[model samples]
Target: MKYLLVREDDEGEDELWGRCANVEGLFVDPVPPPREVLTFRGCTPAGPLREAVSRPGESTALLGNGYVEASDDTQVDWWELVDAVVLAHHPSRSDPSLVDVVVGAGVKGAGGGGFRRSGPSRFELFVGNNVSAGQSLRVDGLLAPRQDPAKIPMELIGCEPTGRLLSALRRPRKREGDWAELWALDRTGQVMAHPAVGLGIDGTRPSVLGGTLIDITLTDGGDDRPAPAARPVWEAWYQGVPTVPNQWAPYSSQGRSAWLRLALHARRPRRPDRSGGVHHLDGRFVTDVPGLHCAMSEALAGPGGYFGWGWDAFRDCLCGGFGLTPPFTLIWHDADIARQAPADAVSACEGLLSYAEEIVQVLEDVGVTVVLA
Candidate 1:
């Protein structure tokens, strides 16, 4: 049996402790053990896991989280405790007796909130009382350090955790219009085209039919190349549109990045959140582009090809960092943009190619590479 232990903060120990993902446990103390003895338990504690307190229960005491149970009840509940770990020196290299079974005559921590000792590593997540949709948990912890005494913000891992890491280590902040961005990479070490994301809609503002636009930059493909400090090429809407990576510039190198969504499109237009060029992708009607039907159909297979940014690619690109819906067959609505007949939608979609080209020019003027892709 594997379990985690949460205890009351006694702050009576001086030793080292190890915390990790698939590694186990957490550290809550304000001061860390500079140097001390450690103990290994359960599975072998290996690289990066600098273990100290050798023996469980025998090692120096560590502080655990605690909170008032109730004003009227005057009781203490374990779950109310904040998440954290303490450290102390130990002489042996062994694991905590985190897992123990009960027999006919025995029980453990009977009236205690403390869990059994950890037999293996596990992942723990943290959320703040006021942290909302667009805010990163990392930023909240850093900006309010004492509020996060346990250093719970340190352990974060995602595809593009750069911004989170910065928030954890540096605690950088936003001034007016700038949103701290996060970048990610794939297994191949290629930078993820999708950088940052936030939920599309908020429930508080009812009758809300749209989302915010993200700011981005267009930079030449180079390592030292810096994105223009001025403005981004495009700002994509967060909702009611396709969300996916339209293209990955094989031409780009490891040094440079293309903030694709930073200069992309989305359907929502409640009010532009961030300032930048806004290319609206009207989902309800096909205005500019001629041949593209609101829905996908065989008609797109022919003339719409030139103006097409690959159906899936277009949707993914539009969705930006948020997840994308898979491209599906087009389902036509009764009234058509052509207003002629059912057969004209396809040809009309092809007509939109000219408008598409015009938008391409608009993007190009802003230093964005609007490849046919």
Candidate 2:
């Protein structure tokens, strides 16, 4: 038996129906024919065609706008007609041990009339834990006989990952705001369409991945790049006295200044009623970009009054060897103002946040507690 899959166009042309009727094969046309040619309306021939295609009976030739013609000796299998790649894997909502694999590709609808004239489509399938991103596979199994052919469910039979698929996954690329193109490739290395994938970190590096520093810079401004500077010397206090209890604290002598007050609230000391050790850092600062930089530099100034104003400088100070001591808490007041800064300034602020996250991760790795509020 043979099957023909014809897609409907916007103009409502039904020429393919005539071709299917004249040919001595089973026809699976989704678009309704003219009323004079066929009285059936909202009726589709998907059920019979799906049964004919999947049952282990006789050889078949699957013909369609997107389908390739099967050879004489080759048995027609639904899986052989479609190609897909694993986009991501998550624990199945129904079962934990089994993973819910998200696969995507450009597949023609099988029987249902719900096929869209789009390139690549995404669907989820349940698979074993062995399945992972970058793995390519073929679709096999039966489609449910329904009006919406697009809802056709199929099983993914694993196949070796193609070199192109692996290469694309290892260095995924986003084109024209689409990440789907990274995985929607045919066996012959042809890309179907650009699709989106949530695979990369959201900010410029240095990034904190699993508590380790990723030494990659993502900002175009080069703010996180290492710069040549004098060897950092550590200092604990200034003029043999802790700086005033203002926002600038003991680092005020270093030319570090903030527009807000920095007050250290003492808690009950370890010994009953003496005094509580300073427990947490809490404060706010100007939300503007330039103000933010100045406030941060002043708040984190080191012993010699040295405070770097940019991400590179801040990172150096956080890694010790500079003047600022570890186990400190920083309370950033009015931090939300940065969001309204100019576009370029907003980008710089994001880079600063990235650097801060990385620094916090590194400090935590060494058991040094640093809190940013």
Candidate 3:
């Protein structure tokens, strides 16, 4: 089985580790990430990486067998090895072979990006409302009267949760025209996601999936042990985590950050419950998002012809509810779901649809039309 598959748009694979990997990092695999899933693998293990084919300087990721080579190592020399074995990261400003750079692009399953034509979406983004809903659906040659959407990449900037490391990762080396980070290549010889951390612990290698993880820890840096939030160790798994923070939680501006994304997601039930892992969450996940019924593009086409009843069927939500994720795009061992771990986050448009409904219903039940997005 091919462990790594390139996601439709992302330069990296849609990793299945958890919200960070599945949603944020984009680990490619057979299945898509689920809404309320059980994360199986924590960090990628080594053993399998060293056995794979490799390139000149690129090595493995600190996480596991997934390969980790910088996709844009176009310098004239062998700097990748120096950076990989020394600094541990090499950032790529633009994702390679990007065909569609769009936002607010999509058609169905609740709401997220508008589904239409594709464009150069450099991710000038907002979690939900920094701009308008269906924010200017920019695509192949569809320019508006007063706007140049072409500047979306430069004009609207979204923050990656890892902004703190950008400088160090993108730094220029003493060698002119050389990148600050190392470039990794896969068995098929492709540039993979930059691991960012864990280079040179003991001669790292690359994985067929793109990169392998080195067993290293940088969280303990800066004299005193940094807080848990700064570390690379996966967040601790526990039962009863809330679907949203308890109102007073501090939020990071980089909404896509793993920790922040999990907050808005559904809470997974603990062990010993009858629901059988997350299957018990069936009925609870669905709810209505404000203006959900009104939010569709006038051109929705009505579920292929059901009309009033067809539109109404969406309101019923027979499938998974809003916020609740579906079966994972990738599952680690067929058996042993526990090893897969509980899902605490979501990103799929389908899963987000479940959430959109849930939010709408929550407001409607209170007799308050809180929002229409």
Q: Which candidate achieves the best TM-score against the true structure? A: 2
Instruction: Between candidates 1 and 3, name the one with more favorable TM-score.
Output: 3
Give me the candidate number with maximum lDDT. 2
- Model 1, 30-141: lDDT tens digits are 2321221212122222111122123445433222222211111233222222322323332222334331111011111112443332333221211121111011111111
Compared with the true structure, the alpha-carbon lDDT of candidate 1 equals 0.23
lDDT of 2 by residue, 1-373 (tens): 0111122336855212110101110111223211111011111112222222234543232221122111123232221123333333444444454333333333433333233324333222211111111111222221322232221111111222234333433464421121111122222322211112222212222223223222221112111111111001011121122343333322322223211211110111222211112223223433333344444544554211333444454555556554444555455444344444444332221123432344345556644555444
Clashes of 3: 63
The TM-scores of all predictions, comma-separated, are: 0.17, 0.22, 0.19
Model 3 scores a TM of 0.19
